[model samples]
Target: MDFATWDDRVEKFRIPAIQYRALVESLQAENTIFNDDAKAFYQVDLVASLEMEPYQHQSEALAAWKLAGRQGVVVLPTAAGKTYLAQMAMQATPRTTLIVVPTLDLMHQWYAHLKAAFPDADVGLLGGGSRDKSSILVATYDSAAIHAETIGSMYALIIFDECHHLPTDFNRVIAEYAIAPYRLGLSATPERTDGKHADLNILIGKEVYRKRAEDLAGKALAEHEIVQIKVKLSQHERERYNKLMQIRNDFLRESKISLGSIQGWQHFVMASARSQAGRKAMLAHREAKEIALGTDGKIRILTDLLAEHYPDRILIFTADNNTVYKISNEFLIPAITHQTPVKERHEILTKFKEGEFKSLVASHVLNEGVDVPAARIAIILSGTGSVREYTQRLGRVLRKGQEANKQAILYEVVTEDTSEEGTSARRRNEPQRTQRTQSKEGEKKGDLKVVYGTGQKKTPRAAEQLGLWNDSGDTPNF
Candidate 1:
């Protein structure tokens, strides 16, 4: 959609009418390149001189900043060089820069990327495990919230990475304390289903730029194939599942109760079990139901898929620590999670990059903000219908590399006829009117389909050397 269309929708969606008109009028009035005070000495030559060529869309985004006076959020997709845009904002200011990130992993990623892009300048990390002493500081929202007063008025510009998280009071406090005249917020999936878009708009900046997934597919990306593989419930588990369903349905029928209720939690308990003995039975029934759902069986099948797609770098993401541990141990893959020691996590990630390991399992630690671009394959073990998780996992494999037709395979294992399927559908179509064009057209068995990223970067030769694959095409011991 055009800028005018977006502005109209923003107003219709309860955006402050005055702010909407004012922002548009301001953009119309100032067609100048940019207006930062510190940018007087800034020149386009510096960007060209940095040994990086900006893509057409990247240049357009930069131009939008200049034309719009650089006062809005720029929503670039993951792997779309958001770091470059953040760097450009920093260079334009040429003063102290404070970048607020959502996680420690991303804090380090930004710190490392910034230092490499501008080797002559000092950069510091302010996350859990890093020191904080450079003019350009990378901090987690938790740190920013607590230390806002400490860094008060020292920065000329503030850049929020994964800025969608700022709706929380803790992170938003940093923006309130900051005196920086220039601000830029970046994210691949910026909208939350909870209707916090207005707070996100003001908390960061306006939505000044956006690009959908389908637009990049087959051009800057590969043609993706998504397949849904279905498995039947084991006989024993199926018997238990059918019995439990009958009991729950009977409760609903007798009570004239609907699942969709404002006070659903209490009703769910009453429906599932009416007494202490019944509760115990219901808990056992759930355990059996989960087993019948085929999550563990699906993981085994996924491992077989990896074996077939051997030597391919894979990232396995799950929301449950139990599942993360289970997959890592069952598949004998090196794993990293939030609980993993920092040094250990760093070492495993380095090994993954160096091609020493073929696959790694993780919890939500790698969900967003962090950059693990060497990963060409991803399997989503479990998560709520989070659009951010879906997009970020896709980004892990979308970065340009040597792997031709390298795919971002997301295996979402959901229990048939469960609430999980409904949640998955909701998230799959989360991106406003863009959903029609963003999604592929088809329906398969169950409710959720396996979503894969269609883009290939040739896998480096190192992937093979690391023992991720062999001539026999089997899972590697590493």
Candidate 2:
């Protein structure tokens, strides 16, 4: 095809440049050879060997990936050895590999793991202000996307860590530009609210293996419990919340905007940008959210819980950086946010791990891909409604420890009689339902109850007596 014709076809079909390999392979199978340029340049020898025996589930996942022609996504819970599985894949494939991660922290984590796994080989870094290339490379998504077209052809295999981030408009280009015939995508939660995860089938491959938190809870992960603590807003905070909510509700009603759908939210955002009334409504909405997320009553309950769980490593999560800073200042705890310097963040985490710091506070920075296996307690002061976010936070504390009877606890602090209640309920319900279903399946198979939050069920009355629930009921209104 001529250049103009090829460009037209590519634009019309939305065809990715990476698919050129498949086309060439099909033609070669038909006994057609266009040129010597179609030959593969990445015949790599395996220099890294497996350091340890693979877990049963990890072996099963590897077998499945090999069955699928060495290309697919594997869904494993965080701290369930996903990185090790990727290392195994690299050993089996033995090709020039590029690993893409979501954040700078994860980029460094992967680089360290790759270095340790392949000690004899040179591993390169391509993010956090460093740009070096080697047979095995670890890069942040932003860096990979920026240089994808230039260096995409150097790798024969591409592994996408936190592969859910790959489906974005920009990040997807990295997969499109690479001619790698072998690919693997890894994620604990691959489902996206924008429905972009479907593109994984084209970008990487279909999900060849899957496991949930309940699927490997007792054996691979720690036994855990999720405690929902409902704290009421003070009278003054309640009045302020009600007034701000009233203004927001009135504006929504007048504008006939329903936030039940994504389109409705987009419309509300655009409307808010274009008019004065809309701006006031937006401000009111923000204030109401702030009130619900960071109430004095919640802080009081947090104080009680901190005292109760003293000396156990705790990780506190919040919805915004403001709340993170507030909790950090109030509790005199080290805080890690996006604004935190890399050196400071590392020091904070190191101290927390060594038990020098009993607790750490963060907004959304630690929600994914950061390893904190020593954390046994997690307190959610405020968070988003996304199930992925909730699951990641829970996984942070569920990593198994040396003690066989170790029980990880996640305390979810929600403002009662506010919109956060519904958000919390919706996010919690789906995961619980899925866990229950998986737990029953495991029982039918005569396997151990591989489920978190099922070891000792806490009743509502017990929770209330323990000050985790209000006296009104399990879920108290007002």
Candidate 3:
């Protein structure tokens, strides 16, 4: 009988580590005597008892994960207790576990939670300047990938937080080399724009449990409303936007490039780097996007909405750091960007949570896995076409809080008659296309309101004359 043999050159088995599962299954089917020594070091007694009872969906998710031989991804919306669900999985499996997180903040957060969950257990940290190893360990993806070959066999169960990030080239190596018999992946938005999320089926496992934001609305999450506010660019801004768009359009036509797919965008980027005209076109595109995203009219509308929701905890989201800082300065609000120090970031969040700060503005730092349950109002001043960003920002406010009757409000400020109109529509349309039918009922689209400038009111007819609002009265489906 033939079995896996050691390979001296690679310092690994002749067969790839990823095939261990199939090999073991095949050997078992043939009634072969298989001595499993790879996981011998991982034998440990783990007792993880939850302080709070598992929610209904959590129990169902746990059941499904266990039913799948303890291997698969669990799709739960942000604030739907994905962390707790991971804890439940840990408690159920009760084996040497390795939890991989995407960010250092998340690594620390998981480390804290695990320590609290199992006070007596030996937990370790493997990222952010720490390299301790124990029966239960938490590590950042970059650190885990760097040490995958060495530490892959130390855990019997591996859980990936924000599992969508696991399909990347470098990160996939962690899962490929790890011989963990049981795997679990958790994510709110698992589908990547590049379509690489399909690889999770092989890298981790097929999705075993799933729930959308709307599915738990009013039950496990706060009821939410999506409001769209349309604002027309000023005369000068409008002219500039048109001119820049014309240049971009000319380049697209001459280059025969369609910016529909990821590959097309990459081609445009490469072409822009090589030719002067392409570079000019790319510059024009960026100018147009900036003009559309940060128009004076949108700022005025934002001011008004902030005034209206001043009493509620609001989160302001933007596409870039420039906009975040701009808004922060204009409103004198605390801002968090990639450049913000970790200590400062945490301090700002603490103050905001304590009501010392009513609003906090951010670019992309708070998009995922950051807990801010007190925030009930989220204003999207500007963002990308990514649905994940849209949903994540919305989820920041959907976390259940003491204000059980409080409604979560997401205000999407758009520049009317610009490319932003299409971008906003596409982001809102994503959930309708992918989410479960039950979740769709929670999304209620409000009437589109047009604002001229700060503290200025215009009649509906005046807005219509400016071509800000359409006559059909059909709002963009949220």
Candidate 4:
């Protein structure tokens, strides 16, 4: 009673590896007699090498995952002990395990964590040029997917870090081809712009448990405030930006297309590839966007913000690599981009953590998957409108550190009178544009509080709490 496959040369029946668990379950359900000889995973004694004070929220999360039969995703805020929670899961269900992460940085981080956590277990690395086999494997998504078929039955429990990435065309195969009867997914923001997050329910399981940033503000994470500071472009920059945007707008108006909807944007991209005029319009739009995101005014404001929070570790985030390098070169701070080599990136991050570098800049690479060191401040020069991106940047500085009651801050320097304002608002709100007033007023769920609007208070935290991912296991639909 196995998945059907025939080998012509051997003239023998073979079982499909991917269907191993289903066949085993079906066999057990019907009380069918069969000799099991293809098992590849075995239980091992695993205990945490270090003792940790059990957090109530983590305890609850582990309980919920176990209640769900260990096949679900746990959505928690960044730097709020997700790796610790995963270690707990491993200890509770000790078995051959595979942890898949999205980047080489994360792969190495997990390798270190697993080795430290399970000193006696045979922990191994599967990416970054080292392919070692052990009971516990930490692999990058690329390497794991390439070897998915061969290693399908090797692990019993598959843990997907940043599982939101699992729904991609190729990476999903890592989950599909594995016969791990148990699965756990970890993410700070699981919802994707493409709406592929729903596929996670089938690949891993439903959202078993979740905790937003505000939920554990002073406990698991540091008390933090997010302030919005708006800046305007110079007169010359403004005129040039307007002229470029006009060209793009004229194309859109003439073609009867709007950039407001995803479908319309897709149509515009296709049209852009088809004609010279359309392509020019696209180039105009891109250049205009660059101006808005990297206005000289932002740099002026950033210089002040950096000075205001001197001696404190800071992380600067930008939407474009150009802005990252510009800030790095102008301020003489180290920067990380996709182009940064793996060794160089690791060295820079280590130096930042050691206080050799008080400030560092990057373009999207520090968003997630990498273990960002504790920094008290985050300055966003530019970024997409994704709430996930906003939350992750904020989280880079929210890790509780040596300073008690340390009030972390995230200053978002936005360009005024451009598409950025609407984009900023979109990041803080869901599709329906519904706003529920909070008694506290505006700090939960990646919301930005205006520091210059009505009055300026010494405390940067806005006395506002707007909306949050509800406690009922998912983000609020609104």
Candidate 5:
């Protein structure tokens, strides 16, 4: 085709310049009808073989993929149909693909999704519970790290799900060793508080596209109303908390522990909580007084919240198995943990989808790639210090519904004046790219928002409220 004809086609078809270049390179190398000039080598057929229908933003993403030579991150929100984008990429390339997931649940989810979309394609699942070996293989990071040398040499494409977790040594090693010519990393929240996400950018490719949560609230994602409900501690718990604090202070001072070192603080806390020899004296001092355990009250609060919001799907997250068991038993909600049997876990998830179960109490299991979008609400009883967990847990509830503008409710129950409060504050204050840019002079300052309540207001102040750094102006219900 002549330059005028090529230009006309490009404009008419919305084919990007880079895509035209790649296509022309392929066509000219095959000795198709063309001129020999360098400029003549820059145009080709403007056709896309993408099987799935692209979302509104997918065209923009396609341009980005073309611009970046199809090697970079695509940052779409949880329910923004990123999986569809990956499907399109697979269809466009028509190449053998290897999909790596962070967890077994996601490995299964991806396998099922790909199978449903491409029924005739040979799909495989390589994880703790699934059979392996197929053209489109879904494998866990742990499993891939061990066999990537053999598998990675063959696949033409490699797609990482929940790719934010790829920074770890095993996954990175596998990605680097993989011979796949095409790489795509998918994540709802790609940045990390520890500032290690730059490693992910390098491990996958440059960030080719990004669509933020606020940008898609009403357009591509469900609208969300974040609420914080606080419960007060009883008087009997107050006296015991005071004595426990005094003992913790004395033990820490005696042990000369430092919070600046994460490992040291972690070891110190574990010792204090679990070791009889290390902190038995401290517990003994508080044992004489009536101590209140928050698990029962927290479970009751969670069940009541579910009752209040019945018929809506809920995913409950907790940090410990004890908390998960308590919540599951008290509410009679099916629970999934690391210890849950694989067969039973699948059954629980299936029942949840059929509306046989309204809620699922899990210990950090549903935080990534589980495909539990029926959940309209999330209750975070406890979480790690990392901001990624907070984002992932929130993403679990942000998936779109048949009803547009679906409401997502996230309730965070934090212990006043405890490490939980500090962790929550740290999560909210972590900087984002837009927030950083908005801080410039002459720019509009972005509004600061918090998912959890500030522990400042209460009808009757509880004992734990005395030393709490609650700047949010709301009391946490015990």
Candidate 6:
């Protein structure tokens, strides 16, 4: 018999919540009977409301999770029925579930879907002015992390959608404090730039199942093509770009700093604030990037692409809000940013999906979380060299449409003879390229890139000339 003095201050002997799972299993291994009175959650009788059959991928993903003890991450491309996968998991576990999402939009979206899936159960929201809690709860990451201490023990199952965001400094506490014996993490791209995604191994679980975009392209996802459109800066713009870059490069050379590695970037950031010359060089660097990324030639190409794909759904992505607003005003297209109101965002998405709006523009806000309309064309005006960002943007068009034979096109407008050339090459190194990893034995996989508007499937001369067609990782001549 296990016995301990009951501490009146704590009411009874207490253990860390995370150890609850191990303790119960240990007691069961010894064939000891114990009351599970500490558990506030109980098994539920939930079922998926949708009559649609589960996809092969979804079924297989859930099976893999079950094999992993109902605690692991599943990596699937966006629009691959991850929501349905979550529903299956809820039915499998049938316990009080807390579904945490990255955004308020997703929180509400989950609330609506789960409520529909279980019409009788109360679906509560924990963010955006909604604070109801029930057997099933949907919460924004902010709200969940803030209330983890109180609500962590209330749920037996926890599902983290877009779980990549859970590794942040403030968000990790939700996982650490939660006693949910069953946990699931869902993400299209879980790798974080800061390497914090590694924490997910301890917080949630290891990756149990992964299906890349390439893995499901023809069957589950729409077959798509990536086209690189290299645009050159004009003479005046080139002159200014060269001058600013020269200043920045000189400062880098004098400081023996390289912008190639994360450490080098950190060093440059630290050195930039220590001296007057360094500060000027930093300003010069910013101006040069603006000139390169916001070149007029890209705008011209975008205009032509918009005309070429007129009346078809299009998504225009930019690196900054200024560029998004500029394109939105110039082309009279709808714009979406984080600053957009909730109702406005909902209306814009509804209209875009219903064919009332032909195109939409956004900075980084549209890359994930909110459900964007399925678009046929995606034009990258400017963006960071993040593979996750690129994949999310590409996913906006990867959902198969009613036209079975329609092809999705992603146009990457790259500025030639500038830093963007290298940036473009790096963004294509996502796991979508045959799920390749950074190891010595694994051979690199080829990308599904095609030449732009050439009516040919081969690489175009412009992309070849700018070295944007290859992942050779050669240094660019500034």
Clash totals for all candidate models? 11, 0, 0, 6, 8, 0
Of the two candidates 2 and 6, the one with more favorable lDDT, higher being better, is 6
Which of 5 and 6 is ahead in lDDT?
6
RMSD from true fold, candidate 3 = 11.7
TM per model?
Answer: 0.72, 0.84, 0.87, 0.86, 0.71, 0.86
Better model by lDDT: candidate 3 vs candidate 6 = 6
Report the lDDT tens digits of candidate 1 across residue range 24-121.
34555787354322121111112222546766556556555544455567776677778887777665556667899888777777767876777777
Write one digit per residue (lDDT tens) for candidate 5, span 158-248.
Answer: 7887788788766776676664546788887788655677986666787777765655566666777565443434566656666676776
TM-score, model 4 to reference:
0.86
Candidate 2 residue lDDT tens string, 296-343: 877887898799999899999999999888888989999999899978
Candidate 6 local lDDT, 1-478, one digit each (tens): 2423457897977666765676787888899998886678877677667646877777778777776778889988887889989998887788889999998878877888888889877679999998887999999999999999999789988999999999999999898888788899999999988899999988888888787766667667787777776677889999999999999999999999999878998998899899999999999999999999999888888888888999899999999999989999998999999899978988999999999999999999988788887888999989999888998998888888686866888988877778887787788862222221232223212212235231333322221123212214322110
Candidate 2 achieves a global lDDT of 0.79
lDDT of 4 at 333: 98
Residue pairs with backbone atoms closer than 3 Å in model 4 (clashes): 440-463, 440-464, 441-464, 441-465, 442-464, 442-465
Give candidate 2 misplaced runs (Cα > 4 Å): 1-16, 31-36, 429-478
Candidate with the larger TM-score of 2 and 6? 6
Worst lDDT 10-window in candidate 3: 461-470
Residue 191 in candidate 5, Cα distance off native in Å? 3.8
TM-score of 6: 0.86
Which pairs clash inside model 6?
none
Badly placed stretches (over 4 Å) of model 5 are: 1-52, 128-134, 192-196, 254-256, 260-300, 429-478
User: In order, what lDDT does every prediction score?
Assistant: 0.62, 0.79, 0.80, 0.82, 0.65, 0.82
lDDT of 4 by residue, 90-109 (tens): 88778889999988878888
